[model samples]
Target: MPEDLPIGRRERLLAALRSRGSVRVRELAAELGVSLPTVRRDLALLADRGLISREHGGASARTSAPERRTDGPRWVVGMVLPSLHYYFPTVAQGVKAVADAAGAKIVLRGSDYDPVVDREQIGLLVARSEIDGLIVAPELRHPQAPEMLRWLDALPLPVVLVERQPPSDFFIEQLQWVASDHRRGGETAVEHLLAQGHRRVGIFGTDNVTGMQVADGWRQALRRHGIDPDEQLMGRTGLFQRDARISAFGDVVERVRKGTLTALIVQPDPDAIALAQRCLEAGLRIPEDLAIVAYDDEIASMGDPALTAIRPAKAQVGRLAMEVLLHRLRLGHDAAPQQLLVRPQLIPRQSSLG
Candidate 1:
């Protein structure tokens, strides 16, 4: 969305197709200071190169119009993310950079955290896009996850999970994936706090796969230090719902006041910031009265105390997942299932250091 996006004519044309899902030759010609015939020629070359499909009056990305030149891109991939916002955009950038450079087509979609929507968007990609592979971060924690995962396993295409590892309780054969080591991130958070002489630690995260993983690590780290990972200290609530967070703030404040909790680990920057604000209102000093560690360091420093945070290698996960899917596509069903984990790093600031 830069002001100079329309500069490189061919690259710009392709980017337009990718972003808008289609582009008419006339509009592209007028926008690019070129003639209709020149645009048509470029479109033909691109179609022949397999980068796009030549439509009746325009060009379309694979997601909008089926491919006519299957011989262009080495592979056509469909990517389904949890959402288009937050941490996933960086991940998508990594995926696209690799794919575009490698002459591979990728169709991107967001599921908004709903498993049903995830499956539906994926269905459209499969049925209309003619994708040869998939890179997805699905809602694997849903009740319908078992069925949806089974459905995915049955697909003829190569599939790689990004930022999500399949649940072990299920019987789906080994799935290829690349994910952040969030469990270790949680462990690191606790270790940092405990090393600072805090024993009565706690966790508060949004109720999701990530929260669960971080909490799991917190428990492991605490038990290793002979401290109990009490249920009272770790709790899950909403990421965006202000009402739910207000109630959680009251509960957490009560615990801090009663001396049951001295430090906390919170996932996501916004929730952590919100918690810090609530603590300020209650006259509880960060790190002095309540040390904190936040997971996902996107804007974590914006908090009043400049929170310590866990930074996941989001772009690395995306790039690696895309690369793995390309390998899978080449090897087909004979390829070994790959599960890769990237570590998350802890950034210490006033929140925990003070």
Candidate 2:
């Protein structure tokens, strides 16, 4: 923490910077529960103390801000992501590693899955005069996503999206991103189950971008085997409704017992692990009664039988995102934007193979 500064705001600000790498002034204002001017004053003091580096729109950890190179002006980058939890921490770690190596300053902020927050954070970064480029994982679930895309396209700085892939029908040229190809992840699960001679496979997961892509791949893989994909076999639900989730879990267990469903692919670790527990309660033998392949390898092995799962290269995505942004910073904005996808690896455990 910065020495001799006010306890609450300075400590919190430093903590945010360490977790986020960088931050916008408005974001800090909101986080500190202080007014904009107060935040600006605190930032100025911190900068003077050499506790932080004041950049274009916000302040960053002093170490993360690019040093005076004598070769050129300092390069500042703005990054906004959805959340700091779950799948994104590794992503941020990767981004920080690359940025530190390149001697570029990175200002990072979290949008908390709110579309309004996304706009506000990005606007703050863009408002800064020194921000050379941007890396964003926007809230694509918003109703006005297209308008947001247009706005991002109009920004002067080069922009690279981390984990977000806008629909191809939307202007891919306007907003290029690097993301995990979750659709292919789903296909890999189905192919593995098919190879094991499981004919009736089901899918279960929350209704979200990743889940939708995995389902698309699951259906396509089934078609390649000359079988019509069963919509009835697809389960859509979220964790918010506990009774509903459990009821659906019971239904899936019944299906397995009756030999109507021979295997299942479930996305995200929590839901898959929950389903495994439910199956055990229903006296179903894993792989013997039914096999399971889970998407998102996080904690998948914690299940009683351990789960076969798809592991996305999350840190690599972060590393590649910064690399892509660095490439854009060197080349002018006139250069073509790059869109890339990283494939997830399918990990086998006792849940599916045993």
Candidate 3:
């Protein structure tokens, strides 16, 4: 019998046995540059721990008791947004569908567009150990994003961002997210306006990440047409304070005076309808005075003039977001992050043209 070996030596011996199936005491001694007695003692400890089997003056791989592997706890998904209204519900639908297929449950937490609330929700999830993973559409951008990511990373769980890009120009590029191609959506929206013979197309949207991206898309489309993206024609004032209604009203009033704004692409349909109603009250006619196109056809349909809008597959986005999350959860934290972009469709209606 050999004397007790150090923890490191025991580990090395176990690893060798696991890899090579079995090892003679002499061979283990020679491989680890230790005495035969020391190798035998190390093997004995491992065998006692049921990590190996000692026999024939040597050791073999542990085959009697298999190492346990668990799927961890049931997955808990976190969502940070204003509500389960028009867009969020669609995304939730997709997430839920995929989660069901993957044998996971979701814990949706609406932050009501508050970062503090989002932070608190994350703390709750971590403290409770209720969630194994997170798919968040952050209320704010990068510095805030890194904070959330760092916290989740420490817990050694998977976290995926859905339908948002980080705000601060910092490490947002490094994070993973699933979102629609708003730039292309903007281009498509503007192109639709142009096709209807309106050159001076105005765009309206919120100051959030999705809104900014759509605004950029609109500008890029205008630049592609050799039209300079004029700041005056753009209406997003402050990134935080600008809502769809306020921005739409500002755009309507500002452009109406300049008289260069002919057609418009409003990211939210409600805003477009509000502007149209304002215009109507001001004695301006739709398609005659100003042709408007809005995004999210479902929301746009509520107004008097059924809006021509860019309709991304709402249910599909939700379903696909869930699919992405499920795939991430299955792969675990060691897996590489993935980014998915859903395409958009343009729905023609009476607001833009007859």
Candidate 4:
């Protein structure tokens, strides 16, 4: 074998300092196969970075301390979101901006909107001691149930809920959560259509909590307007499926052709865009043939006929979640749980009106 190359001096010095609180310059120099002056220089640089403190003769390890009421952790912030789709990426960017200012690193994972995957990712994060805090977009309807809450309950650091809420009552009291008022968003969309004189409006969504809330908003709004909601106009797509989206849109188009639906409220921009396409292909003119208002305002920029949509304040949600999480980190355990409701705005386009 070739002669064993010397170990990096920085690695050797770090290992020595970790085992013992303090290490002499000569000892690190000898162990690292470097000169005494070089070892001292390395320790001085480490001290400058606040990684360690140097005494008259050597350097000492840092003691583990809880975050102060005004100062956040000097480590990592774990962030778990549902997906990189329509809105979550914007949330990630917002978190990144806050993390940059706070000098904390962010670790990201996606649930793909699946509870099982979310659980697995959460378990992996909780197992790591390097993670200082957790910011999660939890699935409201999860099959794992108690095990999931048990996992969250066991974490030592502050757990902040972002965007979506879990079903557990304990988390409701223990966690700081920030989300768009999706129920109000649903109500706003339906109420807009109703105000414009559309009585038999269709509501389409997934079976997820956010979806259910949006769907329920439509029903409640219709009830408020003295219109009996049509169950036939209600439809669900699988959590994340392109084919399910196509089928769902097709079903809605068939209903529209039969004169059952005069307006529609669909969640997220993906399904709304798909629905718009199917309606156009079926020889239906928007607003004249059928009116649509999507949950996310993304589609208004895409096509010739822009989709009228209810735009969730994604950037604001992301900014507020980070702000609350950072506040919790600085204030520690005594800080009260915070709940923020950011409003969603309605953007009207050609798809919903003349």
Candidate 5:
């Protein structure tokens, strides 16, 4: 059998397992004349299909039928996110990719940036016992977040959070979550600015949890560079309040003119774009007068001069959230809760070329 063909390799692996009852990964790799990773992947696929049972360093033939329902009852997973547009659609696509591959049905719902709505949507899924697991991206900073998480913890089905973490005060041992390293993204942006010789950098953050983490990263980066963080240089704004964002933009421009800030990091693409426009209107050239870095690379490239941005692995987060929930569903209460953080990449553009 040719090892180059996956079907051939898998068939060979099954034959070897059937004859030997069990086989170590290295032994299988040597016998199949395939790489260790290739053998491991084949073993995983066979295990996923209930054809074998995975062991510590090997796999064994299943003596009885796998616990999965194969006749008619398909695994149904419920997914809830904040929005279907911008930033979340890619995540939803990732989730769908895994669900489709696993032959599981996904019931997706969108919430309106409100924790109450998140609770309502999740409750609806819970009431329907047909749902086997849930993947949710709720507004964890909301006032009702603790109560909502408490309620979720009590649910019988497995739940995995997407891009959200529980409050520091809450003790949730069983809760699992996947999120981007926003704080590290912030620090990376500051490091890039500092590398470009920008002193007295500023941050325009949002009021959300993601924004808070970015700000924390920014602060840490500044301190590491021996620059004292200025409270006046850090401004917080609401996500969708146009008037408030405009005010914050004006404040940033004023600081730039006063020579208090040479570079700035604005979060969530919209605010960054607005600030860039305001800077241009105020007769300040980007990278020359005030270097700019935007978080959430969604629309950063669309800006004039193409703003430098932090690109979070949102799709990976979504896929991992689904995978985690599925693992919990399969392994039940014995599965250890997973806290995964995907790192963001820094995409430099003309906006921060100085």
Candidate 6:
């Protein structure tokens, strides 16, 4: 058998230890075709389990059956998100699919885009003591975000951040997160618009972390293409704040009429649809006078003239977050923290064709 195979490493090590009474680390590394560090780590794990006695440079098998405590209790994961309806149900469904396959149960809770509520929901789950791990999508741009991160970092159980990430300056060694590449999604939208001969572009985003990332991508893309970015063309409003959009409509129309704003990349499909409606009412033809690209793909296709959109791999983020948390639970302290960023795809439609 090939020595490099990992499937039977532990069994082979135990057999060698039993037959020889002791196995040198160098000999074990050579026999297993693994590094000395790998052998040492295995030995340490085995020693902790009472499976072997560690010597200066080797290990010896125990005469009695080893008291193994490597296996962990079955996992029950808690999931908390800011919304149950928009942009999160599909993610939740993906998490549920993985949990079901692993024979694990999920305790789910919803928050109303408030960091305080998010903390409360998480506290409720942690108080139960049955939850082995957690998957959370908290409002990371809120005023209490720093405090929340500190609290989450000190939790007893493992946590996997979903959709949201820590602030750029904050660093935690054991923090794990999985998020969509929203910044790249923004850049892609701008590049597509530039490809379509849009020299002057604008971005309408929400006042949230995802929106900020998209805007950052947009700014970076513009700089890369040597286009002078205009601050007047960039606008950010609160989520679900229709009055803010209404108040900005006049300025937007004036800019469109003056030929300063040729295209726009709007975050969230519903907001894009609303902007498109307003543009149409103002006598601007879609893809003719005003081209629009939406950030979220949800409901973008259903809009009039069908909007071009950046489709983030939301389901994959959820699935990977759950998988990472479960793997950490199984490995205990052996597993390393992981930060995964999945790319987003741009779907071109009639909205940006012109």
In model 6, the runs with Cα more than 4 Å from the true position are 1-73, 237-246
Worst 10 contiguous positions by lDDT, candidate 5: 1-10
Error of 3 at 92 (Å): 1.2
- The sequence of per-residue lDDT tens digits that candidate 3 reaches over residues 1-354 is 433445346546645764577889998889889888777777676565444677988978644312222564255565555566657788788778877766677777787667777767655553332455567776765357666554433332345667764444534322466778777888899888888887788776878776888888888888888887784366653321235333345546567667888887776766676777777777777877788888777678766677788987766766766666566656543446676777788988888884
State the lDDT of candidate 6 residue by residue for 135-178, as single tens digits.
99988776788878866765545789999888779967566899
**lDDT for each of the candidates?**
0.79, 0.78, 0.67, 0.72, 0.80, 0.81
- List the candidates' TM-scores in order: 0.75, 0.76, 0.69, 0.73, 0.76, 0.76
Number of the top-ranking candidate, with lDDT as the measure: 6
lDDT winner between candidates 2 and 5 = 5
Candidate 2 whole-model C-alpha lDDT, 0 to 1? 0.78
Candidate 3 collision pairs = 94-318, 94-319, 141-167
lDDT of 2 by residue, 291-345 (tens): 9898888899998889999898999999999888887766654456789999989
On TM-score, the leading prediction is 2
lDDT of 4 by residue, 262-296 (tens): 89887767777777776777788888878888887
lDDT of 1 by residue, 176-291 (tens): 78999889999999899988998899888867888888888989999999998865477764532366633667667787888888898988888888888878878989988888
Worst 10 residues of 4 by lDDT: 1-10
Clashing pairs in 4: none
Error of 6 at 203 (Å): 0.9
Per-residue lDDT of 98-133 in model 5, one digit per residue for the tens?
888888889999996888788778766654535677
Q: Rank the candidates by lDDT, best first.
A: 6, 5, 1, 2, 4, 3
Per-residue lDDT of 17 in model 4 = 66
**TM-score of model 4 (CA atoms):** 0.73
